[model samples]
Target: MTNRALVIQDNHHQTFDNDAFMQARNLKAEYCNSGTDALHAIKSHRYRCILVSMDMQKENPVEIIGALRHAENTSGLSPTPIIVAGKDFKLTQSDIGRLNISAQIRSHHLK
Candidate 1:
């Protein structure tokens, strides 16, 4: 597994301190402020994990996850673990299963 992570967030709407999470995990992160940037990064590199902020005003986190999953399928890449980070996300268990999300980290749960 790689020691890097892909962190996608809209700085204006970020609900959690992603840097602290990454630091605590001892993993370096490549930050993407937009879904477009995130897609490009996923195409070029494999990350140990992906942490996507669910509070983005410009992009829907579910759609972003779908796109990322699609990219992985099309490129024949292995599924990367994806953790949704936010507070009170409305996703149902079915949605999470369909998206193959690895985990959910509530904003208040993170240091």
Candidate 2:
């Protein structure tokens, strides 16, 4: 298995320094600046984990998780762990259960 991760973040609101995180973890990372690109990357590659920025402007992080989950289901792939990263977004327990999110990482924790 590849020690790789997919990072989905909007270009404009890049608050988290994903490179530093990846470097610290000793993992290779593929960055997707949009949901469309992220979807395409998810289809083509398998990641150890996916880190999605919650501060996206064009796409809702929940929506992205839903789509990725659906794709994994239809493709008969194991669910990849997803970690939501952001500064001020709150994910309700209901949303977390529904989305099957693996974990969440606040920006402060990353630093």
* Most accurate candidate by lDDT: 1
Question: What does candidate 2's lDDT look like per residue over 1-111, in tens digits?
Answer: 889999988773577778888999888989898878888998999999999999898789889888988988999989998999888899999988888899888888887
* lDDT, residue 13, model 1: 50
What do the candidate models score in CA lDDT, each in turn? 0.90, 0.88
Residue 44 lDDT in model 2? 97
Stretches of candidate 1 above 4 Å error?
none
Tens digits of per-residue lDDT for model 1 on 27-48? 9989998888999999999899
- The prediction achieving the highest TM-score against the true structure is 1
Cα deviation of 77 in candidate 1 (Å)?
A: 0.5
